[model samples]
Target: MSRWLPWAVGLVAAVLALGPALGPGYVLRYDMVFVPDLSLPTVLRGADGFPRAIPSDAVVAALSWVLPGDAVQSAALAAVFVVGAAGAARLMPSPAAAVVAGAAYVWNPFVAERLLLGQWAMLLGYAGLPWVVGAARGPLAGVVRSLIPAAVGGFSSVVLTALTAGPVALWGRGGLRRGGLLAGALVVVSLPWLVPALTAGAAGATTDPAGVEAFAPRADTPLGTAGSLFLLGGVWNAHAVPAGYGDPVAVALRLALCLAAVAGWAWWLYRDRPGFGPGLTAAAVLGFGVALLGATEPGRGVLAWLIGLWPGFGPLRDGQLYVAPLALVQALGLGAAALWLSRPAGGTADGPGDGGAGAAGRGAGEPGSSAEPGPAGPGGRRAHGVGRIAGVAAAAGLAVLPVVALPGLLWGAQGALAPAEYPRDWLAAQAAVAADDRPGAVLVLPWSAYRGIDWSGGPAVVLDPATRLFDRRTVWNDDLVVGTPDGGTVVVRGEDGLAREAAAVLGPDPRTGLPESLDAAGLAALGVRYVAVSAPVDNRFWSDVDGFSVVVEGPEMTLLEVLAGPINTEEADISGLEVTCGLVTVGAIIWSVARSGSSLGFQRTGVERRPGARKEIP
Candidate 1:
């Protein structure tokens, strides 16, 4: 019952939070875009810049072969909540505390904002954090097994795992060796994207420093940037915040909850001295400090300098991502609070004793070895009257507090995440392109990366689905345009050299993203065989074009085929290096799993307990 309770809690939370989003079709928003029959070859071929979608999209495409794309998306989204809740819950010492921790872990502002932003891949890694923390002290195989979700999430997830759990591995026994093993595991899992990124030459290795200001953490609450960050809600994009989430009442309540959770964590650290506590505390502090770096002028300057020095520092631009470790800390702290609240007055719970050596020896989530709830003490003496009832009620109230404080996340983020089906024209356009054995790339017009589609009933801004709709490569604009709070705009330069070359030849309008006239000779020279207008256009520019034939034309999409010309018919295929690295990563993971002989879902019993072990409080 205890083992299943966390899963049940996670499912309920997922249903309540996702609501209509859990139905059919794709929930397209921001970076989240899913198409029917996503082409694995196209995903592997990737774009000119960083292979951000590499293994994530590759995995999705592989799964789409077995399941409908929509079902795959639904399962992926649901897994975020389910896996996250279960992992966080299992970290707690007591079952009741586990429930509180699990709920708090998935129901926070960080999860809400990231989900709204449609970064499901990043969320998947976030879900696996607790498991990584728990496995940090164990064998290398255990750590590799725990990293499966992060492996699927790609680069950002791997970095997050390193930030959150790396310290824990270092702080454990045989610190250096364990830390090296963890580092090796990360490198092995990161090969799919890492190999491409390293070999991408100067163009792919450098990023615009403008992203430092554009993507820095911003205040989303009346409590200001620091306070909002403390509450785990300082995402950069304003549109990503849940509806009515900034209400003053909600802000106050959330702040109070954060303070209580922090205090509870302090108490737990002092009392139980959990093995992962010191390292987790260090991670939380370091992560929070890193987040703060982007919140100030000097810090932003430093970040920009770092990015200028090397593009590898690009991830630091989005400092809000680092707050994820703090979110985990607060979640576990809330669970510790529940443990304290539910325990009988002047008596500890069933598992460990206060400041006892036995408490420090046990690993996280070692069932029956940590704490458990009851009115009785170690001596089997039960509490009577109001004391037990009060304790139970208080613990229960703490469990419900996270939901009450962040009401905006309920019911599919106030219906902002409702699913919408693709129009027939869009599907037809995709099929038309897929059926053709095209040797050249598809050029996505409007010459932009993102689109505000009306198919979702309301205009939902998402990365153009047409970019990945075809069975082959599609070249589109990759530059990012960010709107500032002061009504100004920042255009961050793109990394795709090929896209830049195409842009120079096509010369798209800055305002409309559409070309003034068709340059058929120029496009054919660039190896563009087909042009897809993914958005509704007021003017049909391709109608009178000389060197093109219309393939599919509708209100929503227009596909054009270039007429006979000297087309650069270079075939795009996955590089041998990328294939080799992917194969190696897969093999490593399989070997690690085989060596471990136990799945990540099950716990290893009879762990050797080291007595008199003490961890420093950060």
Candidate 2:
């Protein structure tokens, strides 16, 4: 019964955070980034064959077949909180501490901000870190248990999990065996994203200065930075910051709460003396330092240098991501503190103490001078009373920070999965595109790669909706360029820009139409059979365009047919390689899951370290 309580609390918090946005239509953020490319075949092929870590996308796509896409997203969102709490609890010394830690992790400002940003893929890694830590603590069986979740988490998340688990796996004698097993499992699980990334030479393109700056932590001071991260509010986008972001009162209260939690955890670490406490502390500091380093010019410069040297390092540009591990470590520390305060007057004989006869009793050491055993035996009400008071204080400290910092989180920022209806004409336009039996591509007018959407009310700039507006194959303009050694940026279009060169011939002015820019012959040469415009445009853009006829003229948009375009059906030799790699990735995960008997349980409860476990600090 105690085991279920923390999960119950976490579930309720997660539901409250996402309750309003659970709808039938795709949410603004989900549709903007994920919906456009939600097809299974597309995932198998890899997103533009550039290794953008589409495994999570592929899994979500596969799940959509069995469940409604909206339901799958809701479940995934809820799992972030549920798994986070469960894993955190496994590392904690007591149930009370676990409950508090779980709530603190799930309801904090960082989780709230990322949720609002609609970065589900990155969050998946955040959710999986605790389990990774548990599995890496030394046991071949544990590594086997960690594969399924790691695979489902996608590539970026797997990397985050590795950061947390690697330190633990590398400590003590014979650590190499356990660590090697863990690393091999991670590699196998990450193949879906890793394989494509290696094959497609565009991995370096992902780490742009713009992306680095976009998610960097923005705080006034070091203390402020730590406080904001503790409350989960380090996102660089000003508009996306938590409610009451820069208010003096809110800021002060948040810092106070963070200080209290950290101080409380430190006190608990001193008293409780859990074996992993020191390592967790180090991991927290390292993660915090890395995140802070990425927020400044020097950090970005360093990252830029790394990206130039190795394309795989490109994903690390978003320094804010480092905050997840720090946040996890903090949550666990807070839990340990709460549990310490609630212990009996003499402390539990089986509780985790700093090498004392408590939770770490297997190799317990002397108690601190102030922590000497009391005359009162276990279950004494007097000590319990004092402990209850301390427990309340710790929980209060952990909860207040997020509550005050992100008050509007529960009521705002949710995007509907499925609404009752879309603009009727928009639906008709999509139907027309899907109806076309031909294999030609589409050209979306106001042809750029990104724009503010109607659903999100222009709060953030997202990928162009035109890409997802049609069921037929489509093409859009390139938004990023890769840097070459010669100081020139090269535009590499993997798969999407089928008609880019031809579309380039059409001058930027859409209103000028075919006469001055492109004629019917040019349209045919580009292999573009259709064009759709969602935003308002002058009638002249379509009126004078030759070899095109109005197919569906709706109040919100216009759909045109390119009556004389030639469709190209050439296949790439590399297509077979992509499919084969995807298959092997899918098969490996399935085989591992079967071999492990589907037991992905994180059983790291209690304080018994594996025999021969090294005492060396990570």
Cα-based lDDT for every prediction: 0.83, 0.60
- The lowest-lDDT stretch of 10 consecutive residues in candidate 2 is 355-364
Model 2 C-alpha lDDT per residue in residues 343-428, reported as the tens digit of each score: 44444422444323124433222442223343445656566567656766755565545655556566434432222234567667
Off by over 4 Å in 1: 200-203, 352-390, 604-618
Residue 452 Cα positional deviation in candidate 1, in Å, after optimal superposition: 0.9
Backbone clash numbers for all candidates listed:
0, 18
- Per-residue C-alpha lDDT of model 1 across residues 1-618, encoded as one tens digit per residue: 666778888898999899888898888999988889999887877767888778789889999999999899988998999999988887776667888998999999999999988999999999999988888788888888889889999989999999999998898578798789889999999998888777753345468999999998999999889888999999999999987678998888898889989999998777666777888899999999999999999999999999999888999999999999999999989988887777655445424422122344453235434433334555444453355567768877887888899888898888888888888888998898878885888999888887788886456789888888899878899999999889998888988887898999989998889988889988998888999998777545877679999888788998889884878866656679989999999988888788888776664211123345343221
Worst 10 residues of 1 by lDDT: 349-358
TM-scores, all candidates, are 0.93, 0.81
> Whole-model lDDT for model 2 versus the true structure?
0.60
